[model samples]
Target chain A: MNGVRTIFGREIASYFTSLFAYLIAAAVLLITGILFINNIGRSQDQVAPNPAAIPDFFAFALIFFAPLLTMRLLAEERREGTLELLLTSPTSDSSIVIGKFAGAWAYYTIILAITFVYQVILLNISQGQTDLAHALCAYIGIWLYGGACLAVGMVFSAATDNQIVAAFLASAALFLLWIGDRVGEVIPNINVARFIRELTLQSHYASSFAVGLLRAEDIVFFAGIIAVMLFITIRLVESNRWR
Target chain B: MIEVKDLSKRYGDRLAVNAISFKAQPGEIVGLLGPNGAGKTTTMRMLTGFMPPTSGSAAIGGFDVVEDSFEARSRVGYLPERVPLYPDMTTEGYVTFWAKLRGVRQPAQAARAVLERLHLDDRSKTLVRNLSKGMRQRLGLAQALVHNPPVIILDEPTIGIDPQQVIEVRETIAALRQSHTVLISTHILSEAEQICDRVIIINQGKIVAQGKPGDLRKKLNAANLESVFLQMVNKDKRA
Candidate 1:
C-alpha cells in the first residue's frame, strides 16, 4: 500500500539519521567480528572445525542488538506524540505496524549482510575447504531468526511509550526465547520438554538450517513467530485509538 | 461538511465527551470553545478517526468516521494540540510525508504549495527540531492543509506560540474559511470571538452553548465574549 511505503520510507530514513541505528550496527559488527576472529582464527588446527560457530555467535548477538534497533520504532513515536498523527491519517493500523516492522527487518538484514564478510573470511581461512552450502543455510537461517527477533522487539515497542521499558521488555523476551531449550532440558516430563524445546528458537535453528539441513517446519516456525508477533503488534497499536 | 451526532468517549468511568453533537457547513469556520479537559480534543479525535467513540457517530464529507474510517480520515486533516512532528525531518520533508500519506497525487508539489501559503517556503529545508515554536506551529498547519482536504480539525493550534505567531495562525485559519470546513478548538474566548463564524462552548464534556459569537454574547447579556464564556462555564460548575 502507498501508506505503508510512505511510512516505511520515513522510518528507514529516520533510522539512518539517528545515532541509535549506527550504534547498534557498530556494536553488533564489532562483537560479531571479534567472536569470528576468536573462533576461526584460534581453532584452525582442529580436525573438523564447527561450521556453526560464527552463525551461533551471530544469533546470540542479535538477541541484544535487535531489541536495541527496534526499541525506538514505535515507543519513540508515541513519546513524541507522532503516533497520533499517524493513526489519524488515512493509513490503516496494519499498514503502520507492517511498515515499521518491515523497516526494522530491512535494516537488520543490511546489518546481517555486512556480516557476510565474516563468511568470506571463513572461506579464505578454511583454504576453500569451508562448506559453502552450510554457510549459505546459516545465512538464511540467521536472517529469518533475526527477523523473528525484530518482530518480537516491535511487539514490545508497541506495548509501551518508554524506549527504556521497550528495550528492557524486548531483551527479556528474546533472552527467554534464546534460553528456552536449556530450560526445557531441566523439565521433568518428556512430552513437556519436547514441546518446550520445539517452541524454543535455538531448537528450530539448530536442528534445521543451522547445520545446512533446511526443513519446511523450521521455516514455518520462524514465519509463524513473525506473523504472530506482528499481528499482536498491530492489535496493540489499533487499541491506542480506543484507549 | 463535518457532522457529529451524540459522539461520546469514555476512559474507564470518566466520560471525556458526553454525547456532544454539532455540524460545520461547507466552507465555514467553527470554533470549539472549552476549558482544559472539557473534551474538545477528545471530540476532535473521534471526528478525525484517530479515536473511536464509545457511542454515537461522526462523518466527514458524507463518510462515517467509524464505519468508513479510512475514507472519512482521508477527507479530514487534523492538527493536534501538541503539534506532532518528526524532529529529524526538514519542514518540506515532514509536510511531504504527510501529504503522501493522505494520498496527494503530487506530494512534493502539494507540500511546497502549502509551505508557500504559510510563508514557510524560505525555511522549508530547516530541520523541525531547529525551528522556532512558531515556525513549528506553522509547519503543523502546513501538513494539515497539504492534502487540500474538505474538512480540517485543529486542536489548540496556537497554544504555546508567541503573539505574532498566534496572529499568523489565526489569519491562516481565517483564510481557510473560503475553501475548507474548519473546526478549531481553543480555550481563548477572544480568539474564538474574533475568528469563528459560530462558536460552540462546552463545559464538563457537554455543550453549554453554541451560536454566532455576537448572538451568544447578546443572549447571555455579557459585556464581551470572555465574560459570556466565563459566565457559562461558571454557571455550569455552580449547577
Candidate 2:
C-alpha cells in the first residue's frame, strides 16, 4: 500500500505538471459546455429539465479522452526508461498498475465535477424541476464508466512502449466496446451477439444509468471491467522482467 | 553486501547472462567490465531484482533477491545504463519520489540530504529537463543513494557525461566505499582500474576473469587493464 501511495502521488504530480493533461481537460470542458447548451435548448421544448447532458456527451468524449489521458501513463515511462526505476524498486507490479488507474480516475473525476455547473444552471432555470436523483445516478455511472475506459486504456499502455501506438490501440478497443452491441443486427445468432454486447462499454451504461435507473448488474459490470483490465495490466507489466 | 551463485538469465532460446557468480563485500567496490552485448546490464538487472533470473540465486544484505524481493530490493540501489529522469519533475521531487518508493522515513529530508551530498541542492527546484548531462547522472546517483542502501549497482554511469563530471562522479562513488558495497559496470577499463578494488570481466555472457585490478594485470601479463580486457574477450570468443 505504501508503494501504491508513492506511485499514485508521483502520477498525480506528473498529471499536474504536464501540458498534455491540461489540454485534454480544457478540450473536454469546451466541447461539453457547447454540447450542454445545445442539449438544453433542444430539451426545453419537450421537458423542463435535462440532467443527462454531461454524462451523455461524456460517453462519446471519454472514448478519446480516456485513451489520450492514459496513453502516456505507462508507455511514456517505458520509452523514457523510467519503468526500470519502478520495476527495480521494492514496489510491486500490482501497486504500479493500481496507482496509474487511480491517478487517471482521479483526473476524470475532477473533469466530471467541473461539468456539474451545467446541472446547477439547469436546476436554477427550471426552478428545481431537475431530477437530482436521475442526474446523480448518471454521474455515478459515468464515473465508473470512465474508470472502466481508463483501465482498458492502461492495458494497452502497458502492452507497448510507443505512446502513439498505445493511444491508437486503446481507441480501437474502446470504439469496438462502445458499438459492439450493434453486432446483433448482422449476426443471426441472438445469444452470441448478446454476449458480445454484454462485453461492451455501452450496455452497462445505457440501460441502467442513462435512463435514471441504477441496476446492480451494470455497476458490477463496470467494476468487473476495471478489476479485470487492471489485472491484465499487472500481468503485462510483470512480463517485462521476463522479456 | 551482495552475493550471487550461478545467476543465469535466458531470453527464450538465447542465454543473455550465462551461469555466473561473484560477490561484493561491505566497503568494497567491484566493477563489471564487458563489451556492449556482453551481458553486464543483464547481470545487473537480475541483481537489482528488475528481472527474475532463469536459474540460480542472489542475495543482497542477507535477503534472497527472488524469494524475498522486497527485502532484497530495499537493500539495493541501482542506476541503469540510461539515466532515467522524468523531465517534468523538479530535482527535489524526483529524489523524494524515489525515497518514498524505497520506503525511507522522512523522505523530504532524505532527498535534501542526498541532493546536498551530490552538490545538487542549489538545483533542487530546477526542472530535470534543464539539467546538464552530468547533473542528470548525479541526480540519478542521488536517487540510488536516497534509500541509504548497503548495496549500490551502477551501470555505465559515466557513459555520456563530460570528462570533468565523470571525474566528480567517480570521486563521489569512491567516497561510497566507506560502508556501501558498490558494483559498477563501465567500458572504460581505466576508470574501473582507478576506482574499483576488483573487477569481473565478462564476455559472451560468461565470466572471463575476476580479481583485484592489480592482480588481474599481473596474471593476464597485459600492459594495462584495457589490454587485459581485450585479450580475455578475444580469447573467450575463440573458445
For DockQ, the strongest prediction is 2
RMSD in Å for all candidates: 1.6, 1.4
Candidate 2: TM-score of chain A is 0.96
Compare the candidates by TM-score and give the number of the best one: 2
> Ten consecutive residues with minimal summed lDDT in candidate 2 chain A?
A44-53
- Which regions of candidate 1 are displaced past 4 Å? A46-49, A124-127
DockQ of each: 0.86, 0.86
Grade the docking of candidate 1: high
Give candidate 1's error at residue A125 in angstroms: 5.3
What i-RMS does each candidate reach, in Å? 1.0, 0.9
Over the stretch B1-239, how does candidate 2's per-residue lDDT look in tens digits? 78989989898888888999998899999999999989999999999999899999999998999999999999998899899999999999999999999999999999999999999999999999999999999999999999999999999989888889999999999999998999999999999999999999998789999999999999879899999999999887787
Error of 1 at A31 (Å): 2.3
